[model samples]
Target: MKMICMAVMLFITLLSAGAQKNIPASDIKTAMMKATRFMVEKVSNRGGYLWNYSPDFSRCWGELEAKPSMIWIEAGTPAMGNVFLNAYQLTGESYYLKAAQAAADALIWGQHPSGGWPYMLDFSGEISLKQWYSKVQKGYIHCAQEHAHYYGNCTYDDAATYDSGMFLLRMYLLTLDPKYKYPVERCLDFVLESQYPIGGWPQRYPLRYEYVKGDKEDYTSFITINDGVHTNNINFLLACYTLLGETRALEPLQRAMTCVLALQGGKPQAGWAMQHKLDLNYSPGHARDFEPAGYAATATAEMCRNLMRFYRWTGDTKYLARIPDAFEFLESIRYSDAQMKQLGKSVKPGQILCPTFVEVGTNRPLYLHNDPDHYWVDYDYHGLITHYSSTRAIDLQSLKDEYQHLLSLSKEEATKDSPFIGQTDISGTLLSHLMRGKVQQADTQKVDSLLTILKKKDYLPGRLPSVSKENPGFSDAPLPSEVISIKEYMNGMSTFIQYLTK
Candidate 1:
């Protein structure tokens, strides 16, 4: 029976390879380049990009309605720029490199003097950007805490600064240009300086603690692990140490890793939270009202992966010690079928189900509801908000499998696979590997479909329900008219790049 399964898998692999061979490489390259050119030339605002834009290019946005001079850093500009770099690696085209350079230039222009970047960069300057923040804070009813006041500080939230710094590093490596090096150095210094004495980083840097929600002070200054803050920062510094031989990043990186270990809750809970108090305790009610202080299922799951990554990076057995308890805690708190139905969630097969927010001390699942005027959280699951999910899909089984796999590896075998293995500088293959880290196999059928669509539209289609003055914010709702998405274009381009490389 095992032989039969093996034979089936081998046949499937051959079939996939054969199918790929049938597709002309030149055709794929042509489509990829055309799509790339359209985005780089027509859609971009000053060589930078937003999340999405209208098909006609009449409307565009990045978490908010952006001005002509503005570009988003989080998954907008840097993401597109990375794709351009990937394209250059595959084809060795100066065009792709030049496009990437333009993106790097834009990011450099947006770089705050403090050595990091904000969520969005506006060419119009600081005063205009602060005024825009005030407008958003006054108009938006939800997420009041996030926009309460503009602090003119670089945010670690959503990986705005970290990702930009990475792009700059990549550019510097490729061009051997000082233009990219100085900013990336400053960016690294900012990270090292902004870290808490105990090691965790705040949601926003240069800690103001001014953002007020009701009577409570801002959560931005807390030691944050939300959005993989520790993980991203650690990886960035590790890359600096590995690729550039920057010694300053090494000690700070160790401190940050130690902070992750310190932040874990005690035995019975044995999980992690989105943010922690400076004293290293669980912090809840962060950025929004519905986020109650407790063990966040998503954050805990990510923490488990972070531990695994740390183990891989350093061969530290201690990192693996807490993972089992974390897994057990996750399994213990899963929502039963009755609870899921009450919460209007259906558990698909093989889906690891749990609530997004778990209450502290008692370990009860917290459900969030959107009232007419405000968002609130409680035990009741009924009438949960549609905007944000009350339940999260965390594959604890995958985490367990990864942990087991790591344990099975000999130390030599594990160390050989580390990114630091015998590498002094970034090679094309290594950089490409980093770019495509842990991503699932790209679907050839989807690539073919996207390429066909791109030919007609000259861009990838995105979901945009409506774009009007009344509803200026973006939405994921399906609409009749196709919209252009930076993310989709990147994904499509990446798929082609991956196939071409193979």
Candidate 2:
């Protein structure tokens, strides 16, 4: 009986050791390099990357217009820059520095004339041409008629004013160039001026007093009605505060943070809700609900990190205490073992849900909706995975096991040869898995081969491929590739890799 027990224990120990040996650090590095390289080559342009490089430039262009965006240049540029930054940090390579600088330059140039940035940029010159066509035969008929005058001279505006400023501030912290400093200051000024009397920043600014003939009247003011004072604004403010600490901007940062906390929804229990106004002292209205939208998790996590940095600089726990609840809120929304299991069952093998849940509330099941009909509806999980990997909030063993399960599921799905289980799901999940330290040499090699194929095919240089309507389950309408929004993912991945290296 004693010998039997001893034998079982020995076998268990061997299995554990075998599992440990199977995880190759090299594989993780290789896969990360592949994905990062793909992101850099494809998403990057001038100094910033286009929001997405899929299906074609037209598709990428369309996705940028489909939403009220602000963070594309700020997020995507810096994200690409950070990838280079990480490479430089790891290898001390001048090439990486050059790449980083290019991205920084794009970001700097992408800043709006108003000292803020748009959520998108018409880098391709298409939007400007469209605008020009609409104005032809109107007030500027001769001006519009002169193709020689506007051919290469047509300039585009930044997509979102606020996001541009915020991204510039972040870039300033990294580069510390005097050139960046002025823009940051200007952006700060613009944000202050644009702040609503009620507290939140308006969705767009100067109210576009009058529209150009043939131009669509800016309806951002009306759209702002539904947006509320959001967590995203709070995050940008916090980022500005962190980057420009103890400056004139400090007081406004404090005010914004205080206002955000005041807007915390109580019935949903403790997490923040979008406030209708900026008053820190006012009671939140019934219109607000605690949904995970508005980049809540990312904002909350960033706020926590920024607050901790603030505490370090200022020696205050007040900022530090705000983190636990925010962290708890983020954790509540992440996929648990049970949740992942259910998601796996629903997704045909290779696919995994990008954003694990639609909202912060519990009592929801994992399911795919046909309307949006991309493989996954949400891309927010990239942020969550990044936060988890960086903080080590969850058990490493648990995370590794879950990643292995995901890898198995991906492999299973790939074998079925379903077109739906394509690069989006495979790349996203595998990259997330590698970030969490579950390294598989075979999987990594496969990803590397796939990336090589993509590059050789010239598919890597343009926007992400859109799903074809011909596919049985595919949606006819365009599905935005989360990869197009490269900034957040780039930063998150860079941070995760840096954390792991440390």
Candidate 3:
């Protein structure tokens, strides 16, 4: 009996040791080099990038803000910027630093006087300057007369300027460069002011409260929910609070959470709307003719997660307590497997169809669309280019998993949600290790091996992200190869190095 017990203990000890020592430092270094090469060789243009690149190493035209000749896609800029930062830290390489700095300089040049970045940046000085001059004539920017600035509509729509601004701030923190600091500060201030008095943010600021054209109008100046705007905005605030020690950040965050809490609608079926009315009421508000005010499962799930994050950061029980209400609404609307079968879609048994939007009170799914030619459905100037709004039935696996995890959590676990919580798995684990001051003894052999796989496939610049969308109506453009997305490259390599090095 004694011998059997001893054997069992020995086996357990061996298992623990084997599980922990999975990564190596040397392989991580090699992965870093290959990723750095890709960023420098294939990802960059004249100090900027097209929104997405093709595998064939050809530049793709911008999808939203990209132009054929000289546009820098804003969506992917931060990914490249952070990759350069990681390379510099990993190798102490001046080459990576130079690349990172040049991107910073471009960001500075493109910084709008309104304190945000445009969707895309055009590097051709004369064209950008001339455009700003046109805005100057309209007095959109008082300083436009003083100097030409990139004045594309400063927006937080779909994580626009906010993401770009945060990346610049991260760079500023490490490099302590003056150029990065000024824009970061201004952008943050703009973000703060963009918050509506009701504590939610408009997709764009200085508030284009209503969209009116051809006798059709709807309010757009309300708090936004699409693309995780509220969650992303408050996350930015939390980042400032945690890293910058910006105490003033707390007020806006609290107000924003309070706004979210109040706007959860009413009983048995209370969930969040995609866009809440601007009057501080809980009622759903219209956005673009097709996106009728409706309860959004995607936005609600994200908000609950972020609220838990806020509660963790603030020790504020209010944020934690508010999550169950959201959970209930999500539960009430679950699409049963039988119903999914009727749709005849390839859905799994446990899987549910989380409608992109649902009827506010009935908890029924909402379907909507309108010809943009007749109405001001899109708030941006490029509204005509958007496809008609369509209903989306997305996989609810992630949200379902997160909901179950939240149900099992104690207060202690709730507070642990963070920026690093849901990032790339290996990188986030490495960050957790580094934060604990455990790097010297960490098991890097496994992580290094994993990174090697990541380099060959993820960091490979073989396929371009330029899809066959009509990005430009009239341009002598070459055909593009359908390949892995910019996200795979950007998120894959950028996050890996940031976690390992930072």
Candidate 4:
């Protein structure tokens, strides 16, 4: 959340060009120094960051919420708090720790008593404290469910609060500060309290549902996968249960995991809906219009990976066994080359535009209306579309390799147990290698190389948005070249930051 980065051409080039290129530690150290300097000089603001920015000496321009701005860092960016901690660990830099502490302080200020934080926190007035008030008294802020004017209420839809709480957990681990630990514990409470009695989490909580006539609609309170509500929260619970040794965390984790497993569509079907209805009987359902209720190819892939993560965490074959069918669901709906040629779309090498959604039972790919506000989606017929958001493509040719690897795991082959044992880990494996103290010069060099490439990409000019109208608290947009991406890291630079700093 600190910075927006995209998939860089250099990364893909390197990947396809060489398989097992090693990077040196010194190179990584130097790149880290430069990257941190850039972050502190250009990105950091009172310990917070604009989603994306382009700096020139003392002046800079920012873009957030798809709008250009002269400067703004009012919301988001707490994830950087932990990223800095990781940086401090790698570099032994007090500067990084200090930066992290400042970010932590910002998160503390933004946090709600429920341990959730809003997507954006504007502190210009008394709005911060007002956000916590639930009364109908004058000057008291209303819940977003009650009034749209309220902006600082706890949110998890875009990882608003859960992510910040996770940062607090890291800070607590680093400093042993009660301030940090307290919020983390309350955040855990929020997770437990927020979970639907049936187990899944809503996009937002306190389960605010709309009272329409005599009926109730869950609204944002539905079990959500839009921004990884349940998965991210389950991940936090897993961390608490594992790292903090909080036995109480176990039940919720298990329940959430069970809910996820159950959520996977069974027999004659597979995969998960991006969001689901509150009713557990219908495990896959809808949230918004654009997000038609169906099997989301993207979320299914993430769910498969997450299952693998749980398997690795607990050595539970149940999670491992969950992998293939999801993959099966994925492969079933993949667009055939014939289909692509039929559509008259030029395909990227090693990539295909996979269906973003597949109609349940029917197993047909869905294409929705272009409008984000509302959409009439149809899976019964095809449509001409290329936008990444509507129908995001994936380099599944690479995934086929992983698919085969996971499939091989089914067999008790000795090599499959430790395939990388005698072979090179060209797949950018990091955690285990780092833990075993087998981190080589090449490992750091790879990160350094990536950071160097990203540093350059961060400065590129293309597809710059020029808003048609001026926004409150911001100036007229700069030239498209002067403007910069706030959400650039949405691509894959986030992985570089995580990998290099770790």
Off by over 4 Å in 3: 1-43, 53-59, 125-151, 209-219, 346-351, 368-459, 462-468, 476-478, 482-502
Tens-place lDDT per residue, model 4, 85-167, is: 66677678798888788877776765676767655554443443244222222221111222233434466776666667777
TM-score of each: 0.88, 0.47, 0.70, 0.68
Error of 3 at 122 (Å): 1.7
**Per-residue alpha-carbon lDDT of model 3 for 1-502, expressed as tens digits?**
9999999999999998886654454666666666656666666665566655556544354443233344443466655676676667667878878877777776777777788765566666556545634533343221111122232356676566766777777777777877787887788788788887778887666655334533434454667877767877776776666556677787898788788777777766566777787563657776654566677777776677666556555546776665667767776776666755654444454445655577766777654433523332222212222243323344445655765666577655655544334322343332333222112222344355447566556464334332334333333465565542455555455445544654
Comparing 3 with 4 on TM-score, the higher-scoring candidate is 3
| Whole-model lDDT per candidate | 0.79, 0.42, 0.59, 0.58
Q: Per-candidate RMSD vs. true structure?
A: 5.5, 15.5, 9.4, 10.4
- Tens-digit lDDT track of model 1 for 1-502: 9999999999999998888756678888889889989988888778898887777666666776556567889878888888888888889888889899999999998888889888898888888787777766655655444655788888988889988998899899988999999999999989998988777888888878776768656888888888878888887888788778898888998888887788888867888888787752544445567777788889889989988877776777888888898988888888788867766667666567898878888888888888658777798877877667778988877888888998899876765656655323445554555555223245678668877896787887877533222242434443335568887788788788777777
**What lDDT is reached at residue 180 by model 4?**
87
Per-residue error (Å), model 3, residue 124? 3.2
Clashes of each: 1, 24, 15, 12
Using lDDT, rank the candidates from best to worst. Answer: 1, 3, 4, 2
lDDT of 2 by residue, 87-194 (tens): 666766466677777765666676556666554444545466445334332322111122112222111122234444544554455568777678768777766666
TM-score of structure candidate 3: 0.70
Candidate number of the best TM-score: 1
